[model samples]
Target: MEPTTLRAVMAALRKPETGCPWDLKQDHQSLARYLREEAAEVLEALAALRPGDPATEAHLCEELGDLWLQVAFHAQLAADRGAWDIHDVERAIVQKLVRRHPHVFAEVDVEGADEVLTNWAAIKREEKGQAADHEPRLLDGIPASLSPMDEALEIGRRCAKVGFEWPDLEGVLDKVKEEVGELQAESDPVRVEEEFGDVLFSLMQWARKKGVDPDAALRRQMIRFKGRFASVEDDARAAGGWEQRDLDQMEEAWQAAKRKGKA
Candidate 1:
């Protein structure tokens, strides 16, 4: 079905007389976890995509539908409460996009991507009234609830826009090394935690400078580790279970697993 039809179906699902009981019971707060989960699943689906892969495209399409359902669900809840609905959601996004992309919709002349970004930031700041509101700090616009790595990257980007950034990638790399050394030198629990966070933040800056997404890099590493660890588990079971194996023996199995790429 089309999006509007699906949205109407979602609205019908919350009707008092004939709606699904579970759907009728969900409030915005209760639906938050589902929304987050669906979004993560959408990302996972997109990450699996390869060029010219129909199966991956289908998977992504389905995952996007699930994500859209969360949007419809939330919009339905608001409509029931006499606030807004799916049409309002669509209209607001359309308006915002046109307003934000003057280079596309209007006569704004942007020489390159960097100029476009600079103009976008200026337009956004004006719309937000960061100056008139006396909240001039660029980082103030970043959401506090963002994951630390993402938050760090955003903070770094905003800082760079204002000339508060390192001269080059080498400077960022040096900062990463410095942060690591500081983390290694720290001993107190609180100090250690602070230093460790700095290390991660500095590493994020380095990753940004190198055109690598810190989150994606970490996720790829985690998947690799999971595969290798699963292989080690199988090897341990073959040798009569993990309880019988020592760290040295497990490490050997893990190394072999990494080499063989067996999960």
Candidate 2:
């Protein structure tokens, strides 16, 4: 977020007579979806970044600016509603960084990176609420609307922190197999849906054990799927065969595109 460009954007949005009608119409609830979409786009752009790829790097930089616009827009809205301003937000962030990272800012007992992380988690738990003994249940902090796979991984992580977890990936893999069998045995759509969810949860657990981000991996595959499908569409158009295309033909193109996509 360039300070001058950000200031101009804020000013434009807040301008009484000339402000954007759409921007003026949006409330927090309506803008939330855009925030999520923009964030996902920024993540996708970052993933595209590579060494010596100036064009991709430039795209990432541009997408980051777009991502920042969403943040600044939300900050402006909050300021307008008397909740908080961007300056207060920055101040709070700086204050928290100084407060939590006592290793750098003050004398705190941190022997290693792991200890520092443990200290940060300890501080966060204390800030959340002092129920150190009871253990905030594995599912406590995650939002319901979080992607189900990510939600499961977070639940697994929190539970693992409190000793309520499998000792190894084999256990999670076994659960995945069990969930798959349950999915196979189901006839009812509702039961199938339930079993499918269990499968996703179990796989997320395995991903957690493997130290892989299920959300990010899924996003990467989704991007590949989108790109391959677009290529397949172009292939069809190039062949002058649009309406006549069926699943078999699409599948052929999909297989070709996927091979290239993976490469």
Instruction: Write down the lDDT of every candidate, Cα atoms only.
Output: 0.85, 0.82
> Which parts of model 2 have CA positions greater than 4 angstroms off?
1-5, 17-26, 81-83, 111-114, 128-131, 134-138, 230-253, 261-263
lDDT of 1: 0.85
Kindly state the number of residue pairs that clash in model 2.
0
Best by lDDT: 1
lDDT of 1 by residue, 92-169 (tens): 999988998998999888898889888777787788776735756666768876877889899888888778999999
Cα lDDT tens digits, model 2, 24-71, are 887778888988998888877766667579998899889888888887
- Reference-based TM-score, model 1: 0.87
Candidate 2 positional error at 182, Å = 2.8
Candidate 1: pairs in clash: none
Clashes within 3 Å, all models in order? 0, 0
